[model samples]
Each structure stands twice: as structure tokens, then as C-alpha cells.
Target: MTDALSDLARAHGVATAYTTDRGHRVDVTPDTLVAVLAACGVDAGTERAARAALEAHRSERAARLLPPCVLVRVPVGDGSGGRGASDRRAGRRGGPQDPGGTDTTPPLYLPEHTHAAVQLEHGGTVPLSPGLPPGHHTLHVRTPDGRQACAPLLAVPERLPAPARRTWGFLVQLYSVLSRRSWGMGDLGDLAELASWSGRELGAGFVQLGPLHAVEPGALPDPSPYRPSSRRFADPMHVRVEAVPEYAYLDASARPAVERLVERARQLNDSVLSGSSLIDREAVLDLKRRALRAVHDVPLSPGRAAAFAAYTEREGQGLTDHATWCALADVYGGAWRSWPAELRDPRSPAVARAREELAEAVDHHRWLAWITDEQLAAAQAAAVGAGMPVGLVHDLAVGVAPEGADAWALQRCLATGMSVGAPPDDFNPRGQDWGQPPWRPDALAAEGYRPFAELLRAGLRHAGALRVDHVMGLSRLWWVPEGRPPTEGTYVGYDRDAMLGVLALEAYRAGAGVIGEDLGTVEDGMREELAARGMLGTSVQRFEYLGGSTGRHGPLPPDQWRADCLATLTTHDLPTTAAWLSGEHVELRARLGLLTRPEAAEKAAAAAERDGWLAELARLGLLPDPGGEVAALHRFLRLTPARMLGVWLPDATGDRRPQNLPGTATVHPNWRLPVADARGRPVPLEELPRTALLRTLADVFADLEEESPHDPHDTDRAPDDTTENANANETEERHGRPGSC
Candidate 1:
């Protein structure tokens, strides 16, 4: 790349070159850099254009008296002044601070006799210097040179509060775990029951679920939860039909139609459980929508009507735009880009007229959003009430679908012609195009990050904690220009201080913990910065290797695990423990043409990795027999210092199939299978209490409670209600024991 182009790219926070995970350097082509710059609304097509853009950027910076925003990290205190006593505890004390409780940055460039003060968010004003409380405020400055400037100032907590003790929980893909009362898939009602039983009976401390964000409505919608239509709202399809309060008040005229819909939903559930059909999301959604329409027709009491009105008012314009998009989608389609030219812009006069024409439909979608929010709040309440310290840890998807609600509603904040993706890596030599647009850094700063702040606020509203997918995006993201290959993408950076400041402030206000999925292709110091904010990192068992350059690439020892992390045996995207032990995943991959290596070589490598863990477990005296391997692996997790441990829900029952297989879409049933046992028999929620495999695995993690006993309410052990070895024998008969490799 030419020097002029590189300078222009740097001015826009776009990288002309980057170092790969391997120890190699690759320079981005000049053409790629220009295209990416154009996506950021810069003109850099030629050397002359690039030089002009650079001059403009410099001139703009010199003319401005203050930056678009300022991030202030406050000091720790004892609840009276700053972060309080809880913030100084074991896992929460690494925030950026000097002796004076402020970060080290160059002094501001202003004329002499400059006056500065902060306009508090609520009411009054205070001096900009000295200690400022942790909240959002506005900074005002006036200089003797007759210049005045104002910007948004964010004063955030030094560190978030951590759990008082070590805790364990179940990690699940909610749609796969069904109950008898579910309408062909899991719902909020099922989540409540799962959390209540696990916390009260098995001593589990949390229930971390996959993202519940809304998906686009259509005859055939994308099934992956990671590519949501809107992250700000919960999916109404997950709402339990019977749990809505209005269901009980339905008039006689509306009763028979609802009854018929419920009966058909039961048939769908039975079909999935019997292995005759995969979970049909579209069909289930269709049934629920019809039944909900009947319930919506029921008259609400005065108090309930007032409550709904309050919710709509609090949500404000964001909710209205989302509901308007939904109403438009019903007439057109979910892809807003293809709508009529006049209606594409959300603020156009045509849209306002359309909203009036379809007022009832807009209200229906708004009502759906409100009802789903109520159910989510109820789920969190149920978990906390059942004695969980950290209940309902929710996941946040990295980005929304390009044709989805968020992309349409917030077009000004997103890059127009660039797709968020990854560069070429070892796992994917051709690289990957995720088909999601990234947030424009310049726009985020210009708007004072209101869109980003609102997104975080909504996610933490009903969560005890929130897990961020691809946390590395807070610093930088790869931008692939439209109609270009992923191999030609360049990295674009963001203001990390501002991004993290907004997150910390919002999470602090909600009293919620934060966890980041920093698993792959992470930048230097990203994990450390997250730790400084008291955010936990994720550690998967199979990916934790001991040595990098010493040629001793074995499984990391349990004792060497990091303390501030959520440790797990496997994740939804990877193979199950049982599949790993039996070499079934390798065979499945080979058959599906997803294997990059020879089948024999892949199998042999997988075996070596599995054996390494087995030897470690045996050495630690955690495994005694082949039948106990699954439990032993979980026992290995408990031996680590990780504060939070997550057991994949499918592992408890010896389910071998992954909920999602990343490479294949239609070839494999992704995100559509119900949770089943080793023999592929569906395991209902009510039946879980009597499963021997689940009971054995629970005992392994529950061993910690014997000494410390985190809960003081119970002094006696509950009677064993599980079946006596029958479930284990049946599993062994079908697939051999989990570890009998």
C-alpha cells in the first residue's frame, strides 16, 4: 500500500496490514483498503483522493476543541463514595487506576483560563476535575479564545461486582430442551422449571442459556440464534401459550379455536419426541401466533391495561420502530431492503402513513414484545427465588442479520457496504463471511454511542449476568467489502475505552455480572482489559492446551486453569463428550465432507487428544472405570480454580449429537433436534429427576457442597429418587460406556 493510502486508512481507524495468529505478516492490498475506507464514508480511490482525505481528517481534528466523548474510570470505595466493598473482593479488583483513581492520558489541548464543568445526567452541575461519581454526564468547556464545546462524558465503575463464592451451572440451547407442556419446543415456563429444580434439588447456582433474541418472521427463517433480527427484544415464539395472564380470560367464542390449536401443538411435540420429525420452528410459530391472537382479543382488567401502557411508554421510540418493521414485514417480507423505495427509510412520510393504515398489526407486534419481556422477567425471578446466587446468565449475539430489524432501524450507525467477517485462519483457509454489517466507529462516536448503550441496557434488564459472543469486537472487527472475498478483508478498530465504558456503566446500573467469549483469534491485551473490568473469560476443556512453543502441546492441567472464567467441558457448537470419546464426531465430519484431513488421520488425532485428557483424569484419581468417564470429566472441571463451571445439558444424558454443526446447514439437522438420551430417545424435563446419568454427574460437582455447604437452609440429604443403574445399563447397551474408546 502507498504511504498516502495507509495514512488515510489509519486516520479512519482502518488497518492496512495485520499480523495473523501464526507468526507471519500479511499486508492488505491497496484496492481493499480503498474499498473499506469508502464503506466508512471516505473518498480514497486514488493517491490524490487519499492525500485530500488525510488533510481533511487532520483539519477536522485540529478545529475541534474537545473529543466526541470522554470515558472516566472512577476509584474503588466502600459503598459510600465509589464502587464499594464488593468491588474490592477476590475477583473484581483490576480496573485501570493510578494513585489518584484516574487513567494516564495526555492533558487536553486548550487555551489558558479554560473553564470546565460537568452537567449531571439527572439535575445539577459539578467541576470536571476531582472525583466524579459513576454515571453518564455531559462535559462543557469554554476557552478564553472564544471557543466552546460540549460532549458526552461517561464515568463508570472501576470493576463490576463478582459472586461471593464459586458457583456451577448448566449451559443449554433452550429450544432443544422440551417438556410435556411445551408447544413443540422449550419456552420460558420450561426455563423456570429447569432453574427451580436444578437450584433447589441439585445445588446448581445458575442456568446459562443460548441467545433468545428475536428471529425474522417468515415461512423459512434462519434457525441459528446467533444471527438474530433484533437483540433488544426477546423472541415471542419462546413464550408459553398458557402462561399469558389473558389466556384465562378468553371468552367462550374464542375458546374452541385456542383449544384446537393447543391440541395440534401437542401432536407436533409428540412427533418430535418419537423421532418422526425434527422440531419445526415455523409450524410451531404458526400455531402459537394463532392461539395468541385469540388471547389478545380478550379484554384486560384496568390494572393490567395500565401496566401495559407503562411498558410501552418506557420502551419509547425504539420499540415503536421495531414493531413498525414487523408490521411492514407482514405486508412485504422480513427483508426491509426490498421494500418500496418510499418506505425503506424509517422516518419517511410514507412510513408514518403506513403505520396508521396498519395500526392494529403494529399494536400486535408491540404486545408480543411486552408479553415476552414479562415472561423473561418471570424466569429470572424464579431462578433467584429458588436460591441461585447468579441466575439466568444470558448470551448476546455478536451482530444482527443484515436484512433484519436492527439493520433497517439503525442504518445510519452501520457500515453500508461492508460485511463483518474473519480473515484467513488455520481453521478456515478461505476465511468466513458472516453476512452481518459492523457498526461504524465514526457514527458510534458522533452519536455518543446511544445505540450501543441501549443495546447493553436491554440485554441486562432481566439477566443476573450477560455473556458476550466474540468479545473481541469491542476493540476491532474485520471488514469485508461487499462483493469481495473474505481473504481480502482488513481490520477496522474502535474506541475501546468508550465501548467498555458504556458496557461497564450499564452493567453496574443493573447489578449484573459480565462474561466474554474470548476463545478464538483474540487481540493482545483484550483478555487482560476484560479482566480489569471484572468480566470473566470463557475456557473450553478441549481447547485449553498446556504448552505453545515447547513442543509439549498436551491438555492443560486442571490446577493451571484461570480463576476468573467460565469453564466448560464442551459448547453447543462443538462435539459432545460422548461423541468425542467414541470417535463419532470424526466419522460424522468425514462423511459430511467437512474434514480437511484424511479420515484416519483425523480419527487418530482426536484419539490422542481424548487419551491425553483421560490420562490426566486417571492421574488425578477422578476416573476409576469406563462407565464413569462422563462424570470424571466434570469432576476434572471442579478441580480447577475457575469460579464458574458450566455443564452442557446434553452431556448429562449421554447425547452425542451437537445442537449446531457449524459447517453444514441442510445436510445436518442444526438447531432442530430435541435433547435425547444415548439411544436417541427424547428426555422430558419431568423425567430428568429420575435419570441415573444426570444423578451421577450431579454428584460429582455437588461434592464441593459437602464441606463448605454454600446453602445453609438444608442440613439433611434428600432421598435418592433416580432409577437404580437402569438408565446407565440401557445407555451402555446401545453405545457402550461414554469413555470405552
Candidate 2:
């Protein structure tokens, strides 16, 4: 059984991107699991410690394939145990400081280390060395961490970097990027321009954009950018067609309708770009799709058609199936399942009947996709034109809707009896069901993992970098069977070997770097798995802190964290720096009664944590005051030293609205809100330069430090030439640029 478990670990490690370390194979069978741990230099003492650590996670009833293997570290010697608080110091001399009270700087602990490296599958070591050690250490080890992905902490040497070696990066949301050329929302054009400017001016190495995936055009079509239709495709709304070379040759008379559609899109974009009004993403997408369709019908030369056909083949049945669904839905109805039973099974003769009936619509949908694909290629091309490295980092969502095309098309591959969700955690105690279907792990391997691989290829092909959201999902997904609440969800493990291997294979070929968003409650050793596969991890400054200490919520100390990571200030899912600074998130959630019981205490504590973090920044002299506004957030972020820094698009513009409100769908505007300029005005792309928000954001982007590991401006002799940079232009006008917002 031990040998089997080690083999299984070797064969089934979940993180497709990070399954192996030092090229050392992982054994899933129990004995090999023990062996793998030993290979990591874990001795009998460490193994005994790991077993002791694993005991607490034991289940009265074991879960097949998933036996609470994760071991939350408990401190010994010092009599401390359980995941140690990430805070730097156990006690501080001062209390929280008030932003309004004074410009007093508070004490901050920016602990770091350069010792204790992470051993990878490729035989490379990830120097996790920090300058200062937390009261206790937290290390993630594979196999050794029980089924839960948790492992016991093993301390190594602590070698801190000199203070002068530290660096900082800004964070922003892409949609919030306002530029003279952008439509209402920020597009790739805006992103390119922003990256170029930021990379060059602020000396910023990388610029992070919001998830830029293809989305449906409709009122409130799930504004949470994370829940996308197709993670592989770029959102057509981000396409800046005018920037396309073909756009210049459209016959004058033939271009009128195209131009007219652009005008309407621009008009709709205005609702988002220049006003306090919420962005109607669906309206914007609808207009852009229509416009793109016109462009597609522009009689593509044989070469273009041939290229599109090749793309169609490359996108495979999934893309084609989705296109077919869109076409059928336009005429038959919104729900494909609700469509005539004959049309339900894509491979069925009934589908054939439906296809005949909706041939034109299907063709139209396919054409739209082709144009979207072409434009995406162009956008990547633009990045290359701008001399950006790691151009167009595409974000891959966690899962797909059960009723959506993926579920409908690959029904056999998905678990019909289960949905994916989270277990009870600090933030969401009730636990949460994401309402998306989970893949049948068994089915995935049987099918040669084609579905997952194909999806990855689509996304990676056009991107210089790709981010796997909730990367831990590749290891173990919380599977809540149908009719079960999220809390009842059990863990359904994947074939981690295949998943991570395929991901590495794809990434290796694409010449793209991988970043895993390993946030929230993660299983132990998950980070180790990712690090082993040469995948970068995500580290957020705001969430970094100590446990007992104030603001000790998440991964603390940039220096203490792993080096193969993207250091960021904020995320689209979280409040922007500006919003966080103003405490608007808590207030909004409170208004909605979203806080847990004893709401007042939670609010006060949360406020205290926020203030405590600010106080620390002041102490370090990173901020002028213990509590200032958004600027303090920026300065505070600048204190962390991570190699790859990601600046959110919205943060640059000081956009207050979060791209996503995790618990709220309809209650909160969510993804519907487009980025506006300062003073709450929507600043369209064309009008971006005119807006104070855009200027400030651009100024911020320009002022960031340059030459991050993932630099956009670096033009070394050898590289992929697809990434674009600093190119805001007319194509961006489709969203609502230069007008009305």
C-alpha cells in the first residue's frame, strides 16, 4: 500500500504545472510517499514529525483517494504548533495609528531569508531564504504532507538579503486602466501602452491585467471576471481592431457599417469609461462581437481563410463546439440543454438537425470566433511590436459552468453528480459552492487528458505568460456532489502527474512562464509542488502578515516567501489599493450585511488589522504617516522584495470597485462596473489621458521600479517576438474610448 501510494503520487500528483522536484519523481503509493519525503532530505526524525503532524487531520471516515494527508505545522521546542502566524514579531510596542491623526510612522517588520531552498523536479533549488524568521517556520513538502497537502515545518539556515537588495512593485486591475485610446474599459491596447509606459518610466518590469478572456455580451453576464466562458480565448471586447493591419484596407464604402458598429460600441463603452455609471459588459461585448462579425465578413483573402481554418483545427472541438452553441442559441434559445432535444448532444443526429436549421448563425458565431482569435494574435503581435517580454499573460479560470458548452460537450468527462467548491475557512465559514462542475479525474486520464491539454494549448499559444488560478485545484478540488452544500464537499483528486506534466510540456513549448495564484486556504505542500515544476507562486503584500500579530491574515514577509513568485499589492478579486486604503470594502459588505455574526467585532478587528499594517509601513519609513490614503498603500507595497511584481490595472488608476465580490453576485455590481477616472468619472480610452485618474495611474506606472525578473522592456538577443508594449490606439475605441463616460 505504501509503495502504491508512492506510485500514485508519482503518477497522480495534482498540480499539473508543479508535480516534480529536482526532476525527482513523486511516488503516490504510501511507501514511495515516504521515500519521496526521504529523498527531499527528510530523515527519520522529520518523517516521524510529519506523521505526528498528519495525525490531527485524521478522518473518522476516510475519503477514497484523498485521506487528509495535509499536516498543519505545530510549533515544538517553543511549544508552538499549527500553521504559525506569519506576522514578523510576537508583540509590538505601539497600537494602531489613525490616518487622520498624524503623519507618524509606525514600526514594521520586513523579515526575509536567503537560506533553506526549495528543491525542484528540475534539480534547481528555490532559495526561500528570508532575512528574519517568523516565530516558527512554515514549509510545504510533498508526500510528507498528508493527503491534505499540509506538511510539518522544517527549519533551515536563515540568510537575509541586504536592505539595498530589496525591491517593490505596484498593483492594478486592467479594466481600470484609462488611456486616451481605450474604449470605456481597458483593452489589450491599453495594457500594452500601460506596460510600455510603466516598464520604461516607472521602471516597472511587468504590468498585470485583469483576466482577458472571451465573455458573452449581456446584462450582468456574471461580472466576476474569474468566472469566464472560455479561459483559452481572449475577450473580444479587448480587441483593438483599428490596430489591425487589415483594417486599413477595408474599402471606404464597405467600411461604413463597420465604422457605424464601432460608433455604437464606443457609445456603450461611454457608459463605463467616463462616468460613475456601471459598465454594461454584455452591451459592450454584444456591440464588439457584431463589429467583429462585420470585419470577419470582409472577404478574407485565401491566406486568411486558410490561417483561420488552421486555427479552427487548433482550437479543436471545444472551440468549435462553443461556436456552434452560440450559433444555435442565437436562433433556438439561450440554454443549449433547453434547445430541442435533438440539438442537445453535439455529436447526435439531432445536433445535426439543429445545425442545419441554424447554419447561418453557426457560421456567424464561428466567424466571430475566428476574428476574435485573429485579433488576439494581433494583440500579442502588438505586445511584440512594443518590445515587451512576457507579453499578454493569460489567466486560466478554475472551472466551467455545468450547463455551459464544456459540460454539455464533454459531459462524460465531467462529474455530473458533483460540483466544485470550498470547505469552511476563515473568510467564508459557511463554505462556498462555486456552481461549476468538476472533471472526472478517472475520465481525464482515460481520454489521454486531451480536454485539459487542448484548453491549455489554446490559452498558451497566444500568451507570453499564463496564470493558473487556484492552481491547487490541479492537485485536489473540493468536490461537492449535487444537492450537497459546499461544506459537505469531499476532496476529489486529479491525476496530478498528467496535469502538471502536460502543463509543463505546454508551457515549455510555448516558451511562456507560469504563475500559480496560490491564494486563500491552500493544502500544505501545494506550494512546494508548484515550485518544483518551475511555476512561480503568487504573493500579495496586503495579505502578508503574522498570526497573533495584528493583520496576520495571509502570507507575510516578502523576504520570507519563495522567490519563484509574482509579488503583488492586490488582486482583482480583492479590494484595490485605493479602496482598501479608504476602508470602502468593509463598509460596503457591512451595508449588505455580509459580515459574520458579531459583525461589529469582526469589523473592528478588520479595521485594526488594516491599520496595523499601515502602522508597520510607517515604522519602516515606507509611508509618511501611519495611516494615509492610497499613496500609503502604494508605498507600503513598494517595501516588499519580490522578483516579479504585478501591478493591477485598476490600482494604477485608483479604481475603487473590485472586479469581483466573492460572496455577492447580484447584490453587488461585481464585474459590471468598468474602470472610471478619478472623481468617479468613467474615462474612455480616447479620453484616458484627459482624466486625472488615468494621469495618476500612468504616473504611478511610470514611477515603478524597472527591471523585474519578468521585465517587459528587456530585448535580449534570444526570445519569442509576440509580446507587445505601450500601444494605446484607435482599436481600443471599441469599448468607449475618447467619449462620454
RMSD of 1: 8.3
Return the TM-score for candidate 2, rounded to 2 decimals.
0.68
What is the clash count for each candidate, in the order shown? 1, 113
Candidate 2 local lDDT, 31-110, one digit each (tens): 32343323222232344455443442233213322121111112222221223223232111111111112211122222
Score each candidate by Cα lDDT: 0.79, 0.53
What candidate 1 gets wrong by more than 4 Å, as runs, is: 76-110, 548-552, 625-627, 703-741
Candidate 2 lDDT for residue 729: 8
Q: Model 1 TM-score? A: 0.91
The residue-by-residue lDDT of candidate 1 on 485-529, one tens digit each, is: 989998888877667878888888898899998776666567767
Q: Return the lDDT, model 2, position 643.
A: 52
Looking at model 2, residue 92 earns an lDDT score of 15
* Per-model TM values vs. the true structure: 0.91, 0.68
lDDT score, candidate 2, position 450: 61
- Report clash pairs, candidate 1: 79-84
Candidate 2 lDDT score relative to the true structure: 0.53
